[model samples]
Target: MTKKNIILVVVAFLLLSVVASGCSKKDSTDAEVPAEQQVFEETAEDPDIAEEPVEIITGAPLEEPLAEPEVDEIEEEEPASEGSKAPEEQSTSLGDQPVPQEAPVQITELPVESQSAEPEKPSGPSIQLIKTNGETFYMSLDDMKDRSELHFSGSFYWLNSFGSTGHTDFKGVKLWTLLEAMEIVDSSSSRVKVIASDGYSMDFDISQIKRMDYIDETNQDVKLPIIIAWEENGEAYDPSEGAPFKLVVGQKEPGDINKPQWVSNIEKIIVE
Candidate 1:
């Protein structure tokens, strides 16, 4: 063939081929797009793929909690019962504690001078007389005695007329009598505690004294000589036997020399 005729034939054949291929491509694209969209909708709406209902579990039972018990408010009690008196709240003091109360006391008269002797002082060394109120008086026995030489040397006697060693008379003034003679008074419940220089002490109740009882019981023999003596055996009291002054209680048994009680030192007489 000639070169121009061959070229026209090839160009026609290429254009027909391109037109057929475009038609086939358009049909294929439309079919594939519809199938893909349907598949996607089915995947989205499928019940099998949806989330299942969850089974929840709580450890405790599901029953509702019991309501809190109702609180009954307490009402004030009635003032008094039908025929009874109202209750009274009584106060009490502690049983163990003691309440102080006024106590009773016995009183005695002050020492008043019943009789006054001479103005002469004690012939011996001065001695101190201590009073209950703590006052001290410096005086000799003479200054404080109502009778002369009642407390002097050789004033005491162990009467040996019976010649029996145990049956002798001791002449002296009664202790209470001497106390009364000195204007020393005491109450009914009083006691005279005589202390010695060596710290020995003896207590004599006025009520128990034989002479005091003798005077009170019989109301007689006011002259019975029971004395606080200064001498023994015609000599001044030995310092060992409470020199200077000692108490000699009269014999309740007459002529009983063994009954001549000799006590000494005469430190103090506490009357209570």
Candidate 2:
């Protein structure tokens, strides 16, 4: 064989041995790595491969796992019967109570015999003349008309406290004539009290009751008798002018205020 052929053969065998040794070392390293470590490395390298989550156990393990509690089901109520009422429809509230009715009242009218009658009116105007001897005489206008000698008509001047002076005509019975007829004026009766219906009173002696003298408006001396006047100014006396009866008297002097001596609405005359 030639020298160049021998050298070529030797170089070929050395190259083949080096390749075989490298293959065997790679196979041994792959066999030494655990399958789990290999799979972890492969997973870390490959992004597409999803790694399963690992659970870390802490404290002590329980004997058993807890179970879910069971729930109770609610039952529905049945509808009420036609004859039986529901609890809400029962009449138990205060507004549902029945009201009591009241009875009607009856009225009765009074009979004619049970009613009161009206009182009768008086007959006419009358004066009560009382004497100290417990004797009462009721004198009226008719008594004055029956006796012509007792009635007198005259005009007399009068003066009042308010500077008023006037002369008025009057017609009535004389007080002396009436007293003489009734036997009231005597030596035993010294004073006479004249009272009015409005609680006014005047006192007169026996001499004044029989006669009174006055000075007229002409300053002339005039004499007159005290009279129980029933008419004035040709007209019957009205309530405003002391109706029924009034004791009239004239002024004694020119300035004598004798109007207070006149008793108006004379209701009573007492002789004592």
Candidate 3:
């Protein structure tokens, strides 16, 4: 071969050898890097690739920013309540309010009356007494013998379907005395009703309650009074004329028979 051709061939061979070695070295380095590592290298070199936060949303609308749970402001301490001290006082709160306490009442000490363990048997005729609370009490004439006295005059008219025939005089005890004896607790002005075994009943008006000694200074009787007559004309009434018991109302004159003044066979008395 010529000298020029030989020089050109040698230079070409050296260039090819250098290019082949460089290519082999680049392939080996690239193969050593993992795919994930390649992505990290690219991301590190590229400033534009930033990590952005990811969020998953559901169908329900976000509740008005979750209105941060309300917190009550602490309150200033309050003054001590009645009948309570500051340090020893108990505190209780319902929601935002505190309970109030009432002051204890001061009462005067009084003597208590003595009572019998067992009720005493009545000494007189049997009579049923009903109080306002539907309580029933049994009593007798002798049971009320020691009670307060009530002296009043009255007249009884022989009552029938047609009308009154004649009249008789009477004097006896006030029903108020019997009710008081029953230990009835109610208004004194409450009505008093008397019922008889024959189904006859009479309601006495408390507004009419009056006694001869209680006459007002105005020359007018304050009220009308009711009485249970056990005696007539200084003696007990005859059986034919309602014996043993008869209800009579106070009347100053015999002409007062027009009013309901008589109730016989009285077996029950009610206080209301």
Error of 1 at 199 (Å): 2.1
What lDDT does each candidate get? 0.51, 0.78, 0.62
Candidate 2 segments whose C-alpha is farther than 4 A from its true place: 1-122, 217-221, 239-243
Deviation of model 1 at 153, angstroms: 11
Q: Pick the candidate with the highest TM-score.
A: 2
lDDT of 1 by residue, 1-272 (tens): 99999999999999999999999999888666755465556656886644453343534456998999999999989777666873233333678454455566978765668443334434463334444444344444444344554442222224344653431223333555545555454454366666666666666665644243221112234334445655556555554544366665543444445232455666555554
Q: How accurate locally is residue 110 in candidate 1, as Cα lDDT from 0 to 100?
A: 57
In terms of lDDT, model 3 sits at 0.62
Candidate 3 matches the true fold with a TM-score of 0.44
Full-model lDDT, candidate 2: 0.78
Deviating ranges (above 4 Å) for candidate 1? 1-139, 144-146, 149-174, 209-225, 238-242, 253-261
Candidate 2 collision pairs: none
Per-residue CA lDDT of model 3 for 181-256, tens digit only, reads 5575367446778888787888756554434322212224444456777677778655454325778654444334
What TM-score would each prediction reach against the true structure?
0.36, 0.52, 0.44
Summed over model 2, clashes come to 0
- What are the clashing pairs of model 3? 124-141, 124-142, 208-223, 208-224, 209-224
